[model samples]
Target: MPNATTVTEVGQFLKNPPEGFTVEAFGSEYRVHCSEENLVFIDNFRSGDCDIVFQNSLGRKLKMHNLWEYTRMRKSLLSKRIYVLVSLCDQNIPESSKKEPSEPKVLQKYVLSIDGGNPRIKWQMERGLDWTISSVAGESYRVEIDLSEILESLAAAGVIAENLMKCNPIWKDSSFSLKYYSDALFDFPHWFGFSKRSFKLRLIKNT
Candidate 1:
């Protein structure tokens, strides 16, 4: 029978990622990267397992053609050291979803890699950013990222949001997770701030 892993064990491994690495693990989940110096920690509260988490101040670039182009610029500026953390839940995918399921004891995880559906790969390669991947797995896997390169890519894309601009924030608690989302859909303009630009909008009453 296949072995089962817990979040606590995963946390232990990430507590110390390595010299050029930073790690975090807890609740049967963890993330590690020696070259990128990045780690992720997650605890599953649901009935099933949680996948990886890709944590970064810069979220997805709004207008990129693909993930590759986005990754290229990100690696170039972040000194070729990038950290991407992802977390997953065991939600049901309907039969119409066109995705496959893992067997009873297996799970599939796709990290923030060039081929992992990065929307900008081709454009990035044309821009001259060189990147290679290395994968390691034990109780878990260690994926490498070049931070400098990633930062640079964000700047070039002009999609890096100011609020999440920090390279990495000081997380106060030993076991905590960060999540991002918008209350409204893409087309609906929600009230995020009351800045000058937003205040100029006109309000009208219908008859």
Candidate 2:
């Protein structure tokens, strides 16, 4: 059993989770437990698999799973006054390849934001300055884009690229924070083609 205040705190923490905090799935629900604070309990219970017994510092315990109930719970929390903040971490492409390839490979990188509750992209980079097109006719041209390759690289790095492709505007208007690339971007060799970039998004509150 999680109270409204506790649930709101949990959501806030998830928005900008502190270092060392971890999330794990327990049975059919998700649990965010912090060993440092000795807190552990289910946060979402919509699967109706609630035969669990978990406790936390707040002194609330639960053992049931109902999707509708969970939805109501989340709505109850969202109905309260809250602030949302979106943050983007710095991304840097390494100059040296981990392995050599027979042919030259063009590698592009991207930083994107996905919905924590769903598979959607709140924001992402559309194209790089290097992107170009070759005109073939008066009204026709061959568009050359590296977005696909860049997305593939991000996916390989464990990002949810498929969901990011949806390009949802749900997060529009939300305050955003970013960590700009530091001097590390120029430390690599010039031929390595190192590039630095940023991504943006906005989040809105129900209230």
Candidate 3:
């Protein structure tokens, strides 16, 4: 069971997670942390069928067939909204065949390199983090977050293409507004952008 204080601490830790924390879900002590890979896994796990696990410093394993259940449980214990940030590395293009005719290729490196050029970064925020803490749970809680807000925060963080910036170096202040992107440019393609950037936000929850 997690408490309000524990929830806050976990969120903070994720914002600036300690170094050397691998994405493995097992073989670790009981502490809360997150990584880009882990977040992606969780997101996909919730939307589809999959399993996830985490290990604590003590090298104990915690397995969950469905992360949505645990995510809800965490929210139930919190009094404030919890923000989730996910960063990914951009992929590099593969070498093409010189002699034989081949189909056009796309890179799959996914690792972003700043040395090449400044890559646009994207971030997402979960607008409202709602949860419930029941005394009967003996300290455990459940959590629910609006996915819409998460997508908004990510777009707000600048998920637009790098080439677009070349044409117009500056973007309108409202360019990031959720309504604008959700309605105006909902079908815009996200390309030639960096992914390894960091994102942070507070969890705002009501009483």
Candidate 4:
């Protein structure tokens, strides 16, 4: 089992992302590379397993080709221990998402995940989250995201963007994990603003 590794300090990451790097997101560690730095958009949210990223943000990026490109590159990447994140979308949403779609198709923003479909791998995250919540339920931490919902949204986004500039798709994938790679950092879009992934989420008070 992999240890609970995360680069909380963005500066440290940007400064250095050793070789075998992995970012924790999508209830698991998503892939990242120092070379793809500028290409990846970074951001954070109150609720998500992405050390310090929003679950939704990661979810949306699941619809992009850059992500798949990463998939195609998986073998060349961490070929030693690989678990590619692949999504077999059902293009037909069956019915328009009752979820009122996402923010908007900026023809830009949309972008973001499942790690390995393995249930055990999921528990790894659950345990980590459990410990996080128990240790700091009142303090701070990221939360699990509804992947099912995001995928539904992506299937509706139409095909993905092969050419980055071709269509922009939704937006961009928010960089979240890794450390054993080289020199990368936790960054966010200045335009969108950043929030602590540990910030306590405003839970709905049960009436």
Candidate 5:
């Protein structure tokens, strides 16, 4: 049996997740750190999936078959929330994409956060990290997320576009995501977003 655990250390959680563990969604680069619970999904990525075209990583591509196995494996634990705590890595102004009007070149790369325009960049980082706590239970045939964690820019332009279509507060908030275009955007974050986003889907069809 795979050891079911509640891991704290990222290293322990991921068996040597390669540096630059980044993904793209909404035409932006997002670094994702996933802490899994009763889900052995990552290990299933055998360093790469050649069959999955247009994928960035060498790990095997995840398919509906994998979801079936994940569901089957967790049926006994439906009483417990089988979930993951996924954290997106932050980027500083310098590390941010240059496709936009990147300013303050005086500062060293990564010297400031991507939200260099925000007066409260430091404070915002503490309280405004883009994170999602996704959990699924037997009662609901879908994933559930905390609404407060919705990233407006990401949801509108890329992932979860429909749910956040009405969001407008982002325009006023200087701390809103830069939402720049980048070549790094790929399958990873899109999958991560859906895996965590609250949505309904039929995993099985009734005969």
Candidate 6:
């Protein structure tokens, strides 16, 4: 498992991505220019499980199913800087896994990373949003969101929606019964201001 230090290191890397490095959000890949001698490519694949694949300009390829294995194997070949970059790129694995289980455990979390500068933004927005779902055994699902960062993002983006700034908004204590939607397909859209940009959610039930 990755610890806080690892997560923090990754966050710092993103705050100031190194030169000649670029991240592809759609494919979840990182391209790094190691040096004139070597170039590194990191790609993430999601099947039933998550996997990380690394390749170099020299045509060498390495794949690891988990971070522990990847860290250990690449220690010799990768420098401290390169290692941190790779580790940060792999941090998304745990985030993606948070939604894997059919039933919510004690608490399940989902993180949304927003681009404040996305040309589509019409107002202020949140850059990082954390959505948490809590359930007790088989009881109703309780959903809550951490909105501080979102408010800041919105303000930064010049979004002027007053409703978004109200205290303890509806999202704070929203509840839903798992049994009600157990058989039907449902979609929920979280709209940001008047912009057509929204997060569309599709519910999937396990049989």
What lDDT is reached at residue 19 by model 4?
42
Residue 65's lDDT within candidate 4 is: 28
Q: What is the C-alpha RMSD of each candidate to the true structure, in Å?
A: 20.5, 20.8, 16.8, 20.2, 18.3, 20.2
Model 3 is weakest, by summed lDDT over 10 consecutive residues, at 109-118
Q: 117 in model 3: Cα distance from truth in Å?
A: 33
Best candidate (score: TM-score): 1
Each prediction's TM-score versus the true structure: 0.24, 0.19, 0.22, 0.21, 0.23, 0.19
Show where candidate 2 strays beyond 4 Å: 1-64, 81-87, 97-207
Would you give me the overall lDDT of model 2? 0.28
Clash counts per candidate, in order, are 52, 7, 33, 31, 10, 6
Question: What is the C-alpha lDDT profile of model 4 across 1-207, one tens digit per residue?
Answer: 432111122323423444434444345444344233112323443222434342222232222123333334332222222211222322223246645654332232232222222243344434433443342211222332223333334434443433533432322222232211111133232123321222111111120
Ranking by TM-score: 1, 5, 3, 4, 6, 2
CA shift at 86, candidate 2, in angstroms?
A: 6.8
lDDT of 4 at 25: 36
Candidate 3 per-residue C-alpha lDDT over 109-164 given as tens digits, one digit per residue, 9 for 90 to 100: 01111110111111122222211212211222222222333333333446434443
Give lDDT per model, in order: 0.29, 0.28, 0.25, 0.30, 0.26, 0.26
TM-score of 2: 0.19
lDDT of 1 at 70: 44
**C-alpha lDDT of candidate 1 relative to the true structure:** 0.29
Candidate 6 Cα deviation (angstroms), residue 38: 8.6
Q: Give lDDT: candidate 2, residue 164.
A: 43
lDDT of 6 at 60: 20
